[model samples]
Target chain A: MPSTAGAALPERSRDLRAFAGPVVEWAIWIAVLAWVFWQTQRFDREIAQYAFGAAGWPRALCIAAALGATGQLIYRIAEIRRGRAAVPEAAGPEIAAPESAAPEGQKPGLWQRAKHLPIFIFPLIYLYLVPSVGFYVATPFFILGLLLILEVRTLRALLGVTCVVYGLVLLLFTRFFYVALPVGRIESFYDINNAIIGIARYGM
Target chain B: MEQFLDGTFNLFGDGQAVLIFALGLIGGMLFGAIPGVNMLTLGAVLLPFTITMQPEHAVMLFSVIYCAGVFGGAITAILFNIPGAPENAPTCFDGYPMTMQGRSGKAIGAAVSCSAIGGVASAVLMMSATGLIASWAVRAFGPQEVFALIFFGLAVSASIGAENLWKGWLSVFAGLIIATVGTDPVGGIPRFNEGSFFGLEFSSYYLSAGIHFIPMILGFFAVSEVLTQAMHISKGTRERPKAGLDFPTIAEFLSVRWTMLRSIVIGFFAGILPGIGATLAAFLGYSQAHRWSKKRANFGKGELEGVVASETANNAATGAAMIPLLALGLPGGALTAMIMGIFQIHGMEPGPLIFVNSGDLVWITFAAMFWANLFIILLGWLQTKTVVQILRVPFRWLAPGILLLAVIGAYALRNLFIDVWVMFLAGIVGYLLRRSGYSAAGVVLGLILGKLGESAFSKSMQLMDYNFFGFFERPISALLITLGIAAIIVSIINEIRGADVQKALMD
Candidate 1:
């Protein structure tokens, strides 16, 4: 696809994307104002105690803001009216930086390549398990898992760092700050004193 | 005179007071160094711990945190690309550019010095003009006037949007709409609560939508910024350019001194005006400095003078904000408002009676605030030298760290993880808005002013039986409205002129 530039850019047209931005903004502003006015009017007519009598500074200010917003939309509309909205500008042809920079068609995907579902599911799992397993139990595994997924070298390094971090948090929140940690539902097996004593007995 | 001396003596006399100031200084610096951990959180978190202490000591610590936290935010803002506080957001535009240019040390120095100067200047003005400013605040600002002041804040923010005024207003409008969530302030009517829609019946009282700030600040300033940096990450991070915390030369100092002075004055005056916060103070100072600068074009591109002006104005706002806080028990910004809560919690009512009844305590708080400013300078300066290296942390790593904190912080705000999700969603929206060239300052300011504007406007109408001009009967209200209109007109003229200049340059 040849790049468009300068004269090649769209000279004039009612581009939907360009027009949609301002239209949406205006609709939002109008809807808000109408809603407020209707609410205030209704309240004024209802319970006498609810009546504010007339439009005071807040109403006037809302009207003024709505006008300002409308004016902005008008200005943007004028820009589109003139052929000068953000018509896609052209640039020179693509040049790959060295071939080794990133393997062709192998960029690190933000979420997933074709819905790699676990990337989304993992965070959800962590979020659910966090309070239940407690910060101490959940944090180390979370850190370790994230590190492994990110392809951080060396499992030792990952575990070491996670343990250090987990220990530090446990000390700060539970010991120093005295923030109570949730000891999961299996209270019969979990001993809170043992965990605290173990940590105090042997520093990370 | 006797009271002032006694207050000063009492400050130095108490050992606990020293400890309180020290804790405030350290807490302020720590919080200010971390983006999203603003003074409000630090103060509020410490509030419980200080509850059992003497009122004077607690107040001293609170004021110290308030003042130091305001200045301490510039630390991360200068060293890293992130602003620690929402008010310091503007500082990062130039402050970070300076750091990248190997002037990080001087940037921090300028920020620290100007912060102290601004803070002290505002404190002095607050002490001298507290009574007069209070009367002016109450006498002049009816609903009409307060609304105008909010308008002025938006205008001030909008003018700084530079070439993207449309996008700026868009964000402001977005903020305005979001602010309308919860309950109607005047009539107590529930509007837009979406009850019975998803089997979600929120408490009406809670629905009067008190959005958490720290999470929002984190979302807007930290999360979005980190994501943006993450997208652009290339290779290993560069070593932070070394400029060992050194003050500017005398000539350099002389050049920016006037900017600092002017910004302090502007900041103080804006602070004295109730309902305005550091954002407007900062915006006004930056624009005023640009208007005064010999090389105005160098402003957004890391000018030392620009940093001076912004830091001074924002920091100076601390004490100026206190005037209303002390005199009328009305909070200026979120943090100071929390301080007002503290005053109330401590059984010290802040009003005309506070001046008469607790005059000595007022002086003591001011003194503590002053010392806090000084301590921020010394401690912040030393920390700036050592802290530059922390900026080398990868955005990839830092983002996760911050995200972790954000989750915890939001949950801690009211012990609800739902707030954490709200924060994440807000961050996404905030990031999109930023990428689209909208100002977050407008959003924050709108959020702050929106509720106040609504309630005040409603009350004013009720007081006057809906006669719109009833507010103008007061002389002060009329003057503020006139000035507000004039500011808008001037801003428009300047913007038009700027556009014309740009067109000419293009031609």
Candidate 2:
């Protein structure tokens, strides 16, 4: 049984990828640790000695992270070898879990397992597009796409939300707050950004 | 006494001052409740407008906003896990859980009342004795003490949501690493931020400001939350929050009287520090609440005391933040820094001399804050009844809006696109970390305190000839470090003696 801390328990895996989630997370962390340790060598060698503290704080933290992760890994393996999770009823809150563990029912296909990918990917695309296409032009499309991705099927619901969200942002952020939104480099996006800015700033 | 009276008269006597108060109250609460936008945004937008207004009104307006804004974030933190500002992050721990359990009204009610109590109490303390207290308080905290305090904060934060102590510390270590991303505090050397590591070349000057915790908070709390809910929605396991305003009874407020008092003291002291403000205060309050709470296990599980503790301490910090700004000419946080700008715009400096030169302005602003905190209770009640209605909106409609708000909030921090990138990236990382049973709260705590800790640690080491034990030489630092060490030991003991340890090996 999972504790109340909301640690994503590695679901009783239905596939190899789902089962290997914990191992993969460890690998990524170890890679990060290795990179950080390597960077410690680049500190201004003259003034950056640990005694004087330049690369020292990060180095110390990286070392601690490695030890903590390695210890957990060893302990987890021991628990598995013992044939059950030793969830130590009072581990005191934080525990270990594999990422994005699928539901523990019958085997789901890749699409079912990866349903949450769009949430991540959509934001990345939105971020990537915002700078190039300008914020005002790209936001409506982004909201519409997100609405559809979230299973919002009604056309009225999609457009209404898209328009309301976009309009509210334009009114409050651009008009009232006077924040500088990203105007794109392309000629058309530039014009769109300017037009929106003009309309938002002065009205009509 | 005469200056205080005159300031009170000045604020209430002028009809324009009354209008300014209304605008600040309404504007502050509105901006404060919005997910991505904070009251600082309101302050920044109003900065130029302040130049055209009377100095006292301008100064009073920011003060009121500070009080109302800190309180406003609590509403969102309760109704949604999205904290409107960094200070309200801790409120999300229990407040959102309470909401999930369909007790948002009770959580909001406690938050509103405690926030008012914290704000008004701190304001009263701040008003009559600014000169004596600020002069004494600032002198007491040196680098050694500051480092010890941050050390204590981080140590206690390690076990916040972690059942496994190792996972909690790892989360904190990860945050410390992230905090070291931009620049080394001692020598200003850029750390893991950019440049070549093992023949890898990267250049991003924006790393100079480092990863602001605001983006990290928004990312972890808001963006990751939406993703989690989206997954749940897909799974058909989503729970809609039932709405009902259950204002805590008089007994409920009295129940946490100790928490309220302790938080006020904690918030006041924390606020007087130049860099440490409401965020630290809120976390400290929450941490201490968990420590002393009779219902400690219920803390992250939607405990009312959790909301009260966090909201009170943060709002308490709003008043205490003014202490340094008014008394020492030191801005405690971003909003206060802007208030300092307002002070300068009026051709006045904030130190002890300001008490003599512009005592009326200082006192009038104080008077307005006093009223603003009380007014927030009324405003908060109205907002609660209305904003709680957000729970009625389909989570699908609310979800995308939260993400959009997260984007705007992150970018608004420094007007940098890198912040947006950082926020999105944090969302992904946060999702993974949360899934792994890592405490995002621990990471945030470490991030919030890491820079302060590193800088203060370095300075303390220099002052004490790099001796680790030198911290114990100073009484205050010694006391703090001891308390921190004690907390770690208790956590270790708990882990060792935990209930199901033998079940794993024997089964």
Tell me, by DockQ, which candidate is best: 2
lDDT of 1 by residue, B1-507 (tens): 465567667887888777777888888878777654567667766778666888778777878887888777787777655567766766775676677667888888888888888888787777778889878866765667766666666665653532355555556665665566656676555544443324544344454455655566666656555444433333222233444456666788798778888898878877776667676788778767876788665665568887898899998888888887788878877777777777878777888888788877888888777767776778867877788766554333444455555555566666655565556667666655554455665666566666777776666667777777876676766666666677667755644443523222322
What shift in Å separates residue A104 of candidate 2 from its native position after superposition?
5.8
Model 2 CA deviation exceeding 4 Å by range: A1-28, A48-53, A70-85, A88-108, B1-5, B195-200, B499-507
Clash pairs, candidate 1, are: A4-A90, B182-B207
Tens digits of lDDT, candidate 2, B1-507? 676678788888999999999999999998899988889889988999998998988999999988988888888888878888878988887888788778898999899889999999899889867888888877778899999988887777676655467778888888888898887877777765566756769877888788889899888888888887777677666777788777889998899999999999988888778788888889889889887888776666678898898899999888888888888898978899999999888888889898788877888998899889999889888887888988999989988788888888888778899999988788777776765567887888888888988888888888888899999998889999999999887876665444223222323
lDDT of 1 by residue, A1-204 (tens): 345544345633336768987789689778877655544442232436435432333355467668877777876677666656352111000000011122234455655443333323444566677556555566566666655543446867676666665665556445554544444445532464347535754553
Residue A184 miss distance in model 2 (angstroms): 0.9
Interface CA RMSD, all predictions: 8.6, 4.7
Q: Determine the backbone clash count of candidate 2.
A: 8
